[model samples]
Target: MVSTTSKWTWKSPGDETRNQIDCMMISKRYRNALLLAKTYPSADCYSDHVPVVGKFKLKLKKNSKPFTNIKFDLAILKTNQTIRGKNQISVQNKFEALGDAEEVEQQWKNFKSAIMEAATEVIPKVKRKAKQKWMTEEILNLMEERSCSKGNKEKYEQIHKKVQEKCNMSKENCINEKCKEIEQQRKHAPQTMYSGFA
Candidate 1:
């Protein structure tokens, strides 16, 4: 292939000519999410054409469900007698204060509001925690290294192998940990285990 400073996407082996023939096509909807799209010539794919990598920073919209966010930790009510009693008293007082509504719908709304208000006042909210992922920081770093060393075939290949190995090991470890957790739950809290499946 013809040696040049500029990056080329493809190289004709027989003719020793290089050209940027490959292109990336993305939807207009996700145009803003496209951070970078480029070709890496040193990537050892054992082919005339190089790989085109596209980096995206996607802002996914969360699924909106009715009354999903205001989840009160009901488990606390089961464990703490004081909180349960307070909640009961609060609901009773609210219901009494609500009086009689003219319509059935209004009465139902009032009842629902009363129960929600009482729960909000007495029960602690369930804190939304980020879901745990199988991918580890070490694996991520290795991937980053591989991306960075894409200009050097030897370095890229080395890091790529390491990334694959780390990914497999991490996935296996995550699976084993989950299995152990399930076993423990099955032994100690069989009801909870069954409920999880349901």
Candidate 2:
């Protein structure tokens, strides 16, 4: 059994990794019998760790048999008729308190806002390369046609510049100095782009 109250439990996994709770592995070097409840004391606090629980008396054999060390590896099964009846009533009240459609809609909006912050604000953007990369013509066309906000357009363009750098490409070939007749370039010196960066 594992303690639920232990805060040093779940290790924050990397982005794009599957969401999985940390599992509690039983110790294998035991010389004697081991009880489930005896191993894990804070069973009520852990929301994920304790996979099993129960209330049963031990009936250990005198002989050291295999798998006999585990004294009941299961949760206590309760089937009280009165408790079930009360639970139905409680569940109905809980559902009723959930309010109506408008509240649910607002909740959905809040969820969307959270998703945006997590994906956009928190996670560092990683640029990927395409074998058939979008040419300047395609990008220019996209800029002219896309209906995103100006801020979003600028952010996306910056990300694109980083992506270009990752593929060992540069715009130095395109940027001609002091050629006003052709397209006038920006004043700032172009900076180098880095890996996994945006």
Candidate 3:
């Protein structure tokens, strides 16, 4: 298909000549789904050929599962001493009440049920806070400002730098927080940390 930008995709180093050698191909069945195809001349790729980008519109089917497992927010148990003590006591009491079973399988089932019941009664489920954990309102605002200043090169560059700086800072902070959490887990629950690798 023809590129909308009408820019050459390749250049000769010696002669500085440009050519549209690159092309995008699509299957006949999905050809109509292509919205736009273009070459970006200003892209920072250190190659002879410029990058070709294509936009397409497609309908994706959602596969919903019949059942989903619930995840408990166990971090609360580590942070709150009272809840941790309560959960331990509840599990211990339940185990004591379970008594002896006829078979090993029956004993295991009883123990599992007791733990599940205690967890369900005491622990809270995990809650989704945001789609992107590292993204903040300030970074989003800078991105919006960059998009708005696209027509003005100077303004766009200024905002783009700011956006890059903010994104790097936010990502670094998120990584640092994650590292701290890992260190805490390593110190307090070394077995759990090693179990994750398994």
Candidate 4:
């Protein structure tokens, strides 16, 4: 017999008795891994039924995939004209030098390796940060204010409007900045730039 704190999992309004509507069961083999199972009424699930949570103690296997990953600086490929041109030429020369092969798959592998080597040499890799630059201080502050005023609907609505306005402004700024960057790249690297209509 399994011993538990509360016997019933659910209850009805009109009915005088409550019944066990939920249960946590484990197989005989994993019975020892079962840690605890209980119900909490103050979990704020917005329902008549309380929340039931269970904890387990089991060992998990680690993933076999390597943690480190090779990163390439693709941004330079478009922005730098010299590196881009030289890298393309190098890749073409390497592919031509490879000549014909017996298997088509082997030929493709050789071509791919040549291109990868050229990219690694011409384009340096840089680590990127996880944080977003577009998330301005005003937006973060407004979000904090909105969260703090959760119970007050009027205040929350006012803050929400301000947050929306700030978000729109931030989006516009980001677009303008990107446009400026593209303009700069086009002006500096005219040879690489293409007229889309042409």
> After superposition, which runs of candidate 4 have C-alpha atoms over 4 Å from their true positions?
1-16, 21-71, 93-99, 126-198
Cα lDDT for residue 49, model 3?
Answer: 86
Candidate 4 local Cα displacement, residue 22, angstroms: 4.4
Per-residue C-alpha lDDT of model 3 across residues 1-198, encoded as one tens digit per residue: 556566688989984798889989898988889998888888999888889999999887687955546688899998999989989988888977999898999999888878888898888877444467898888877776787688999999999999899889998998788777778889999767544422
Candidate 2: residue 98 Cα off by (Å): 18
Q: Model 2: per-residue lDDT, tens digit, 1-198? A: 433444233323442332225443544654233443322424566343323332334455585645422222112114455544544455445444544446777656555544433333323343223333323544444433442434687776765665455333324433322243133222342242221122
User: Given candidate 2, what's the lDDT at residue 111?
Assistant: 53
TM-scores for every predicted model: 0.35, 0.18, 0.34, 0.33
Q: Candidates ranked by TM-score, best first?
A: 1, 3, 4, 2
Q: Which of the numbered candidates is closest to the native, going by highest lDDT?
A: 3
List pairs with backbone clashes in candidate 4.
none
lDDT, residue 191, model 1: 71
TM-score of the candidate numbered 1? 0.35
In model 1, which runs have C-alpha deviations exceeding 4 angstroms? 1-68, 133-198
Give the per-residue lDDT digits (tens) of candidate 4, residues 131-159. 55677876887887898798999999999
lDDT of 3 at 159: 91
Question: Candidate 3: where is the Cα deviation over 4 Å?
Answer: 1-130, 194-198
Worst 10 residues of 4 by lDDT: 189-198
C-alpha positional error of residue 61 in candidate 2 after TM-score superposition, expressed in Å: 78
- Point out the worst 10-residue segment of candidate 3 by lDDT: 189-198
